[model samples]
Target: MELATKRNHAGEKADLRALVNGQYKGDEHALIERIAADLLAGVSARAGEKPGAGKIVGLSSKAACREIASRLAEWLIRETDRAVDARPSCLPAARWSPEEVLERTGMSKSTLYRGDHAQFYSVVPPGKKNGRAYPAWQFIADVPSHLPHLLEILRSNSRMQVNTFFLSEQESLDDLSPAEVLAGMPFEDRQIVASAQQRMLALPVRARVNKVNALARMEVADLG
Candidate 1:
């Protein structure tokens, strides 16, 4: 009897021609399909039958349905065994690409290339090719140690409040007035806004004092 072809989660039909031609050496696809078909048929038959009436729907008897289910279970066991035996030797370890590493780390390309602290992380060159791929094992090994610091940085970065007045990377820090900063801050942290404003006010004053001190030192040197 011809078996019904199965489709994947994406609704695309699974290619079983390769398995039928012996190109693949596993019966998992066939076993799963057979089991699913049997279950579906059983459900349909049960739905058609009235409860407590003991009336057979599609099958000759309930015993026939039980036999079909038992056969499917046996076939599943055999297929599972075949699948286990067909697994490749290099199945445990899988290497990830640079893009994947970035995704996991949440670090930008620049940050990954040159870390924030200049020498926190090191990149290993690809083994087979001269490309920019690191060993997945190395990433796994280093994660436990580096993760805490990375998480702290990410947390602090997220907490930082930015607005139109406050330019983080460039522009004037003074451009963002204390009131502006307070306005941008989340409502929950509004109580701490006063302290933040005081700190911001101190920064420009400290800068001005430093500039005056430098000028005074230059004048002394010139006079001498």
Candidate 2:
């Protein structure tokens, strides 16, 4: 209903709750997809009736379809994760090139492009081709001090996981993002290092590569 009616945030929350709590329920993932498609049909019908007003809420058809698809994908993933094994999901919100990263981190291009690129940062395949882009979270205040060291202690290797560790929230640090805490200099680093050590002990030694790869796959499908 929210997708079809183009409701605002609060309206969407209400509609979503009603939809979830209503009499209709089936395979959670499939039901959401089917409902989304049905809503999209209503959207299409509205568009067909008035060519210019088809957008329903001033959004282009392509954009609306993309939004619907991503919402559905996210719903499915969330439900699936709840029912099965849960995993960390890092939003690939920003990517920077070597030059941009060098400018941000004040690190040499040689170090960034080194054989062990995963040590300092995680690289994503570029949309253009033939190059990799670094996730911006790898560096905070031009420092990657905790990322490399923390990732190593986890016995997990991946620049993407490194970024995830930095981005993950730490309760010991009063719900602060690890990167935000790590960015603090001098006198503040004791807890930062201690929390990193404690979290490292808590983290299981498993292949940390899957989460980033899954995130990238979602992007390729435009479900990001």
Candidate 3:
């Protein structure tokens, strides 16, 4: 609803509670009916009409309504993730090319690319093709020891999203970014890993799955 209102798809104001009219009666089918009706109404409004002006007369069947409602939920998750990704803080501080990574870490190309020594944070830079860039912070000090565990929790996130997770200051970590904390000595891996889990949980399930699928597709492209 916030996304719809902000995008001007839902004009003036939008409230989910406002849609409740005592007709639900705790029935699951009725709940779907309400969601499908509002979803259809919103779609029509996007085409050029008042949000509630769309009629449900041609919905066809309950199955169709359920499908529409499911699609609507997925769209909301996607839009929300887009909004999150648009922040400048989502970008890594520095990205190193393969040669730069090899020079800085003094590791063999075979070891570096194999991801055996370090689970290097890999990402494709904007407008680039045929390669991946590694975020610089992942190789900082003892941080590499804790990186694989943290990355496991954030595997579903896009590389930028993972950057955002690590670079942004967290209230849970005494207002230090995970990178800052991990770069220092005596940090508990559990604390940082738990912080990552909390952040990941904030995203919708399908959004996480979408990010995971997107990352997998990018990996396949890189392999090709």
Candidate 4:
């Protein structure tokens, strides 16, 4: 019975080895080395176990194969963790530029120059003569959160020419309504008016309304 059981277990172990080797997509040589190490450890452990006569007997091939599989699974997990840890945490800062910021914010050339000169947002100075220009990391750090506001401002400015809108100040404010001011425009102009309205709604109510009113005034002046 013991001999029969050993044969059955050995067959099952061989089947498992074939399946593992065939289905596994990782480095087969590395996996084989790890399995060999595990089998050696298992042999050493089994050697510590004595029979009734006091002679130590190592594990059978089936038990050794099982131990190898277990160890290989553990090693793969550790290797995956190490690979993930080896990757960089943040993108390199050298690739950012003022042109990227302008594209992202959709600001006019005048607005971009004004923002740069006024120091409204920080900028990285071009280092020496041949070095590349890059934006200050902090300026870009919060850009994701600030994008909606910036886009709204851009949309509002774009509508002024079509809606015949004007601004009292460069920045938008409250108490402005493009809908009321641009009521008489044709359907094409109304689309611009509607777009401006949507952008205004996303802004602080006071600033949005004020900007819309300013744009309407500018539009009228342009018509005159």
RMSD of each: 23.4, 17.3, 17.6, 24.6
Best by lDDT: 3
Q: Please provide TM-scores, in order, for all candidate models, with all chains considered together.
A: 0.21, 0.33, 0.38, 0.19
Tens-digit lDDT track for model 1 on 1-224?
12333323212112222222122334545544554555555565667844222434445545545566566546545444554455332211334566876775444788556542221322334355344543332232112222223323322221122111112211132333322222222222223435544454345433533332343344345545
Report model 4's TM-score to 2 decimal places: 0.19
1 versus 2: better TM-score goes to: 2
Candidate 1 residue pairs in backbone clash:
none
Q: Report, for every candidate in turn, its global Cα lDDT versus the true structure.
A: 0.36, 0.47, 0.51, 0.39
Q: Taking the tens digit of each residue's C-alpha lDDT, what string does model 4 give over 66-135? A: 5566676665454544443443222223335567656644446675565432222332344544422433
- Superposed Cα RMSD, model 2: 17.3
lDDT of 2 by residue, 100-170 (tens): 86774445678667623434555566555456777654443322322444444433435555455556655
Q: Rank the candidates by lDDT, best first.
A: 3, 2, 4, 1
- Candidate 2 is scored at a TM of 0.33
Score candidate 1 by TM-score against the native: 0.21
Q: Candidate 4 regions off by >4 Å?
A: 1-92, 117-136, 141-224
